[model samples]
Target: MTDCGCDKAKAELVEYLHNELARDDASDIREHMAGCADCSSEFHVNVVMTETVQRACRETAPEELRVQVLARLRDLQASHG
Candidate 1:
């Protein structure tokens, strides 16, 4: 096993994808991915899925719908709080 275990690397994957991980943590995930085919495949799939959704959202989001959604979220949050 590498210094960074696959479980730890995968656990931090969301942070890595969001560009929120520290440099050292990101490096550990990279090192693990370099050596683990299964983990790498999963990570790649997550990357592709995230990118596709983001691109689609950027290109096709309805502005009015977005406003409505934000308003609804704010209302919901206010109610909960």
Candidate 2:
């Protein structure tokens, strides 16, 4: 199999994906990815997924769901009282 820079990037892949790599290492990874199609594709997927999850987490629960939860809590408190 042809080397696709995967071996070189593997050690720091997780860190790179998570934006935890140091400045120099991250720059090096970017440079390496520019020349490596496979690595670039994988990086793009990782970044997209990470951003998607982060965006999802930032969303508030539906108002109906929040109301339901609060109603359940009130019921439990009333029963105990």
Candidate 3:
């Protein structure tokens, strides 16, 4: 991620790009991205990653891989509990 001028603003921009911000706060972040080059580039990278994940999700994931992951998660949860 490009280091924007302010840490807080950069964090807000990340949340905004990920659609994790509240409606009222997101508008301000959107405006900041429009005016900031660093923020704009960071947002563009996030957009690309999001699109890549969405496209990848269309392909089938291995069932055995999913089962192994779930089994590990259950084991971890049980150990923690």
Which of the numbered candidates is closest to the native, going by highest TM-score? 1
- Which regions of candidate 3 deviate over 4 angstroms? 1-5, 61-81
Candidate-wise lDDT, in order: 0.87, 0.81, 0.75
Best candidate according to lDDT? 1
What tens-digit string does per-residue lDDT give for candidate 2 at 1-81? 233367767667778888888877788887888888878888788888888999999999999999999999999999999
| Candidate 1 regions with alpha-carbon error over 4 angstroms | 61-81
On the 0 to 100 scale, the lDDT of residue 51 in model 1 is: 90
Question: RMSD per prediction, one decimal?
Answer: 6.0, 4.6, 6.9
Deviation in Å, model 3, residue 68 alpha carbon:
15
lDDT string for model 1 (2-77, tens) is 4588789888888888989988888888888988998898899889999998898888568999999999999999
For model 1, the run of ten residues with the poorest summed lDDT? 1-10
**Candidate 2 weakest lDDT stretch, 10 residues:** 1-10
Evaluate model 2: give its lDDT: 0.81
Please give the lDDT score for candidate 1. 0.87
What lDDT is reached at residue 14 by model 3? 58
Query: Could you give the candidate ranking by lDDT, starting with the highest?
Result: 1, 2, 3
